[model samples]
Target: MAYDIKDVRTAMDPVDNQYHIVLIIILISLIIAAGISVLFTGGQGPGETLNLSGSLVEQDSTGQKEDPAETWIVRILWVDDQNRTYSFQDYPQDTKPDPKSYTFTGDPPPGAQAAMIRFLSWDGSTERTQGARYIMDPDSVTAVLNRYTLMARLSPLPTTTPVTTNTPAPSGTPIPGMLIPESGVVCRNADGSCTARFGYTSRHDHPVSLPVSDMNRFYPGEPDRGQPVVFMPGIHHDVFSVTYPGDATNLVWFLMDKQVSVGTVPRVNTSIMIEPISGYAPLEVRFSERSTGSVPNNPLAGTWNLGDGTITSITGPFYHRYEYPGRYTVSYTVSNACSQARDSGVVTVYQASYTWDTDPKNPATVRFSCTSTGDPSVWFWDFGDGYTSWEQNPVHTYQRAGTYQVGLTISGQHGKGSVVHTISVPS
Candidate 1:
């Protein structure tokens, strides 16, 4: 029988209260289950973001986006192998489908309506780039998004931090004063090949000469000869070392090979000095007075006594000046930079300038005093008594006296000097 609203109300009184309550509870539980299922199963399907890049094609021949077919709505209809359908809801980062990479974040609750995504295309940032596009699981959308965001943090803005890289400097120890040009290689073009010969400055400071092209060819690469390298000729040599002896410092320019570009002038830093130069190792001069019993006014020839560095004759400056009638001094200084040097000598003893006037009209032979610079000192003296002696200093009596001229000559490693005097005798 069809129950009217009045009858249903009447029947409700007969229904058990427990049964109705139970029914209510069961209904509520079913609803909750359904809700849970929907929440967990939900995924990206509708309202999901879409990214597309590249120029849109137009129905018209113009191929420009201005055409109606290239509009946003028209672009969303992507045709695939299956021809499935999907649409775009939002295009973030402004221009849709920009070449920029995209990432998804936190997914919707499970058991909810899912969003479907279809990748349209992507455009490259520049001519060098290859654009990309693809779809991924929306359930994992959140994690992917977080990953991209972390990466985007790295996507530098137009401005970026500058990077610093260190470059080592080109340096080496300067070559010490060159005593002579380093050994040089010279190539001899013989027949069809070349032979290299290494040569050095003279044993005793000499000049060198060679060609330039041959020098360049032989060095760095041992020439056809294979053993010798070539060198530029005419390089002034410096014997000085980069550092002094006993110096712990090792300072030298290490060339790939021995070859140095000596063509250009180089500054000198090493020092070389003449330690010592001896002209007259041991020298002596002697003057003797003739035993005429004539009684020579002055003592004859004084002993030179070169006396190792002690002899004032060449001790230094006054060397040439003093008792010069016997011997003189000579001094000099030499440097290594160049042959240029300084030297000086003066007549220390001016015997001729001295006065000698001893009287007794008659006398025998006479002598004078003087020392020479040569290994074997030679004494050439003019006695006031009209006579001369080889002895450094000699005393003599005038064989026959009248007016007499006296003089002495002395020579040494420092050069030579002489002195003379005038003597008068009367009966």
Candidate 2:
């Protein structure tokens, strides 16, 4: 029998052919397995597992322990770089006379930057108290768990405290001392009005009830504008508020021998007022001297420390421009003869800018770079091609040659800002 050359070769190489076929089959199987794995895992691969453990104790300012029957609920919250929050909760065993210990095991989501641990104490079916929040970086989470462990001594809720009454002095020997008035805060309202809050410190051991009269009154308006008649012992903050027109001046409060003023002319007090305190850089801020209290022979003299390495002796309304993005503290101090007063304000400035370069060989492909200020932590890119990216600097390719609008937005600790640009791509 005569055999063809192909048949002769095939018969001699049957084992080799079989080996090649098996290898091809193995490669196909691996490809299919990889595809399935990606489909199930979303191509992100395995995540990092985190183990957290901590202890919590409930106590008040006086070091009084909480009830043994009370239980604490621990909440673990984490924020990713994109500002998304994820949470997990756990319960602590009510081991009285000792701090409650808790353990949490889970996978930390991708891009997690920070975490917070909050404790809520419960009594039966009702939550009794919410404790302090502990904040830490994600990188330090495991270290904190291993080294420090979660430990917090929280103050009990005010509502749960027992009320105690103080004994009054016998027959009232004039109550010993009087109340001191203080000007607290002057807040600007949105309707072009201003609200001035005032407080007082009572030196007496018992509550002093003083009717609204010339002894305790406000000037340049009604004597009694909801002023508190019954003064509680100890220091009280924002006890009463007086509203006035934005342009109103010389609002004063008198409590016996003590007096405080707001917007007084020939200003007896020192205060600084700033306009446009926060904005995008180059920010222009207006500074006005709200302190006009000058004596007959001693006039107020002051200097400004603008925080940006600049100091000036100019004593009138002035304007300063900040070229960089940052938080700047501006302070003014005035002193003459008897007293000195200082006032300070903070200015927050932010900036957002970017630059782009095109691929010389492929004009349709472009690379972007962010040159923003203020320490941006989050970035968003809009390519105007129906696709968006969260990357700080993203390279994109246009399908066809045309003009496209691109926008970049960034936000961080200081502030947020955005910019847009138009670009042309060549075919």
Candidate 3:
């Protein structure tokens, strides 16, 4: 043995030492066993067991391979039959599951109800599940409901790597839903599905047909005297006409929503009469409404002088007139102390008049002249000769004409008159 140190070292080689080989085989076996344990062991029944997860994930010093064990348990949400959900400690603790509830590991009691259960894991919302998705039977849900209990475990295990997700906001514009204050709403959704709507209307601060959220209220009866009136914000129509003594002042109009479409021409039926408008100011003319329950001040009522300065007395109730042609606009404004509304209509202006000015003997020339008075808005004249004019006075040469009873009319104003003139022409 004392011959050489080198010879002694060589004698200890693995080929000559059996214990080294044995130790190597044991190390290999231990490694294999650890691998098998990584697999989750399931329990009896259709239900499956899931590994515990952590709210946060730990990185391994060695970035080896994808390990099935990689995951974190953030929370446990268990839904029950009533669609209610319950969650216990994310990890097992001394505190017990509700005596009335069930545990994740145990079989549900008979007649128990439950919603979907989840063992969610995450590292700052980079999440994963403990097990594959599980859809319990409807009948089993009842069991979950009866037990209303869920369990979680806290423990760490060797894991592999995980992935990330895309985070974006929900789609579409979300309008705020709010409760209507005091009055609730003036008009709710035509069918009352959701909440009432609030908005602006060019025609009315509060439109009826368009529906509005009415927090406060006023007298609800037809706000505009039952005229199919709607308060919509935008250009719209609101018209009413009044006459003198005979013709009643009763015209009503409706405001509609066209959504920006070309609108139909609105026709108005108006009359004129000489009402002692300014009872005190005799010089100023006034047209009073003959409505049964007439209001003292109606913007639609007006009076005018029937042209030809000589006619002093406008002694009629009211005279009716058809649609006078022309391009004109009539404006009407309605007001209450609280709010105001206005509307207008287009009126086309038209004028025509026949003159019997020719002194029969003077064929080419006229001798007498005629004059008509009042605002086109005030009056119009119809020379019995099938001619009408909105002029104050007109002169003309009679080429050929016969007897004619001239007619005069006042438009929106309350006044109209007629006179006859005859002229003979040689044939």
| Minimal lDDT window, size 10, model 2 | 165-174
Q: Model 2, 162-227: lDDT tens per residue?
A: 323221121222242566776745554667676777877765433567778877787767778777
Q: Over the stretch 1-427, how does candidate 3's per-residue lDDT look in tens digits?
A: 2758878778778565688888899999999987777653322232323335622233354633333433433223344345333332232222222422434553332323324444444334234444422347645644543344332222222222221222221112211221111111111122322121122223111123423223212122233332222332122222211111212222222222211111111122333334332111113333322212112221222233333122222333433232332333333333321123334343232332224455556664443333433333444555555656665555444455454455554343423333445555444
Judged by whole-model lDDT over C-alpha atoms, candidate 2 comes out at 0.66
The candidate that wins on TM-score is 2
Task: Report the C-alpha displacement of residue 111, candidate 1, in angstroms.
Answer: 99
Candidates' TM-scores? 0.18, 0.30, 0.20
The lDDT for every candidate, in the order shown, is: 0.32, 0.66, 0.34
Better of 1 and 3 by lDDT: 3
Q: Of models 2 and 3, which has the larger lDDT?
A: 2
Top model number, lDDT? 2
lDDT of residue 176 for candidate 2: 29
